[model samples]
Target: MQDPNTLCRRAVEYLEEYRDSQRHLRADGVGRSVGDVWKPPPNSIFKLNFDATVFVEAKRTRFGAIIRNDKGAVMAAMSTGGPPMSSSEEAELLAGRKAVEFATDVGFSELVIEGDNRNVMKALSSSLDDRSLLGNVVDDVRHLVYGMHWINFSCIRRGGNRVAHALVQHARNISEDVFWLEDSPPPALNALYQDSLLL
Candidate 1:
């Protein structure tokens, strides 16, 4: 359908049914549910840009995100991670959910998700339901995003997600204890990239 709302709504419903077949974490253990946040007040506006770094060597996933206003200056930037699952799709969804959690944790009440994973973006816009071949990871992501705002998933290319992309590149090569900035590599990432040192 040309109507994005109707499409997203159907996908949400399919996701809910998928979640129903899965186990729920005890209420306290599930980090913050997306329900705690406020929906856009009818037509309110906000945007969240997100991306994930998947490392083949360590099988890790690191997500980076930024919240921006209409003018596009960033209001928030964050990074989070967990072990990677079987498919790139799972990594993408995990990144999306954690980014949303970070936004709500800091009181963002209205937002849409932006990411480079076309797979998850397409799934969020369609009613088709099947394991992402990623299993519970998909359900966990769906559960985390059950409510809050006119949350639409927009597909972007990696180059368009520069800030978050940079973070993921760093996460893949840098040690956990280090941080870097502004085109300057962390000493650790620098060394690893050179193949002169073991990370």
Candidate 2:
């Protein structure tokens, strides 16, 4: 057996190494991207990218959400359908809320919530009371944020959110909600691979 003192020293060294890696990740920006590429979150933090598409012919909205770790590995992904939305912005807002709920359901507390819709992201990051038609949904998201230990809201270009977009497209064919834990469906796997190339 190893000496007790040696084991203690090794444990402390491992912890220091982990702390340094976390610092490095934070310094690099949690989820900030370079141009229009998807970026991973900092160590121990997950990034949830969400999107929504309006199926006007079906009179419904499809929401897609994908949660990935710092290594760009999908931890959880979901493609779900919702009631018809009058506007795209409203659909985006609802998708954001559903994404948050999905993350929490999967037991993630530290998250960087990302979306391609600027208007929805702006409303989510704002402290001012939203009095628009979708204000209630925005409030629901804010309430969910309070339950998280750490959370950040970010707006990225559509290119950076291709996986989620693909999932939304996949939702068009499925009749029921679909979820993948620690994995992604075929539609999103290609985009996931493309995004990881930059990582």
Candidate 3:
């Protein structure tokens, strides 16, 4: 009793699933073929750090991030944004998405995202609550998740994310323009950030 159109759509979805399964199987077979040789693990695991800052009541909202690797070196793509939110939560999600884009564009195999926002991390680590706005963000997050071999989110105390935190605070003073730091922010910002006791 289903509509003919619905049936055709379902059929196409089944075919797509079958194709994906075959592709995965072929990839696994190739890995098995190379099992006898020792291989080093992938090096594309990069660390993504995020933070957000609000200046004035709603005047300035900024989000920032840094992507680093095991060597503690930063990636070329760093960004700070005057994101679309009137609140910190909005900046947090915007920063998170920027991190996701950096990972995808740079072809990282694994991503470890750290943020100073505990609420944002808790929301992402848990199942999406259908009634909450976070559900919408969680839905978009899955798209980035699918591209990674491994993706993990951790909530760190603000003190642990000074580099990213400083970026946001620094951006809060600037105009609508978004800035990418070349040599990192000045020592005063770092000193002020450490003294802020953001932890």
Candidate 4:
């Protein structure tokens, strides 16, 4: 198994590769759209944007989640590390679960859980049972959703998930899970501010 330091280094490298790919896609105008900007949730509701990075070679995964009020102000944020994942889809499913867990722990009931993984979001919002390899994780998230007063699953482009992405990337340097209440971490502050600009 790779040491934590080595895993962190790999995480940073993977993040850079992902960013490069996104840049190339944008330059090709393949995924650019007006809706790429993050939007605030409705009044009395909170938006939780979550993202995850899988270091398959390192047998590890990292996920970050941010909760914001209708004004787009950060209410809480978290960066957490987890065990190995076989696929990005599994990683995303786990991320969504972690995000929901974080939000509920922070006392949020009305929520819009957003992520960049279209397939995961679709499965999450669907009423049908999931039987894939990641079905258990999906079921876990759905069960959490049932406990909420109101909840919605939304899929947005990666560009719109910058703040959460930044948080996941920032997880590289930490040895343990980190949580911020009523504040945004320094690495995500700029992205958080940029998101508020669109509100």
Candidate 5:
């Protein structure tokens, strides 16, 4: 058995090595092609970017989604909360599902769904069924996608999804699902404005 001091040293070394690898990856420009700018969907289609944040101590997860038209106008925004999830992937899956539901509720026939979770995006974009514990959630999202006239699934870097990311963090402060048609939380509005300027 290893002594406590040895274990502590090993943990510190592992963390240092992990940080170094990340720095090297960034410096080498490897495994990172996507830019941080938010891109709009094609003409006539709305883009839905969704994200989630977990609060383990509170045993709750918060989800947020923002819908914008091709012209970079905010169509709608939603923030909701649910039971705590065991993994960020699960939280992301739930956020994607919420985005779909919100789109359907708003009668959007065509759309593009975007998220920062690569695994969740891949599962939803693929034709093959997801057989993991989160399969049910993925299946439901797939069903929603099929119902739409046209739907595209895309993965984005967290930096590019600032508005939705901010909304998710804002969800923790609200009690119920809130929707904004013409207005949004200040942080999200600021993010939207910043992203719009890039268009």
Candidate 6:
């Protein structure tokens, strides 16, 4: 017969392996579910998806935002290039700031702001005081949020924010910031078309 200690050890090992497999299965499921697609906000609300791209060589960061209504029709779009940033997270924070300023300028009171950077989104969405490197940016974004009649900040999978990503890429080729009413840059048109289909 096997010794009791040996049997207990074997049981523990088997249980650990089982638990690990279960964890992996759950992770895999989540991974498979992240097929990013743009989603509209509720009626009377505008959804704004934003993204930022940092150009190390140019020493600048580009931001892009797209605002759409519940019907998924594009309301407006913006692409801006700004000063250099140290990290992508910081760039993302700037994008959030830009989105808020753009919406506010456009007289939009109700909006949902989304981005692909989870860390930046979490900082902006939560009330927790930012004590890290992005503290100042977080503070500014909070100030913007408070000015809005109603605003929701959220993080989305990169796949879901492709159009914003594409817009920033387009911004890199332009000299100045630009906004669109019902049109988009030619390079970003394909991504805009794809997002429309998802809606």
Instruction: Work out the TM-score per prediction.
Output: 0.58, 0.82, 0.62, 0.82, 0.80, 0.79
Compute the lDDT of residue 137 as modeled in candidate 6. 84
For each of the candidates, give the backbone clash count.
Answer: 0, 0, 0, 0, 0, 1
Clashing pairs in 2: none
Segments of candidate 3 deviating more than 4 angstroms: 1-44, 128-130, 175-199
Residues 49-104, candidate 3, lDDT per residue (tens digit)? 77777665756667667666655545533535554566677678767766676667
Name the regions of candidate 1 deviating beyond 4 angstroms: 1-44, 127-130, 173-199
Tens digits of per-residue lDDT for model 6, 26-65: 4523433444767879999998999999999988899999
lDDT over C-alpha atoms for residue 128 of model 6: 82
Candidate 5 versus truth, CA RMSD in Å, comes to 15.6
Which candidate has the highest lDDT of all? 2
Full-model lDDT, candidate 1: 0.58
Question: By descending TM-score, how would the candidates be arranged?
Answer: 2, 4, 5, 6, 3, 1
Write the candidate numbers in order of decreasing lDDT.
2, 4, 5, 6, 3, 1
Residue 30 in model 4: shift from native, Å? 16
Instruction: Please report the TM-score between candidate 6 and the true structure.
Output: 0.79
> 14-85 in candidate 4: lDDT tens per residue?
999998976664453344475688888999999999999987666688999999898888899999897777
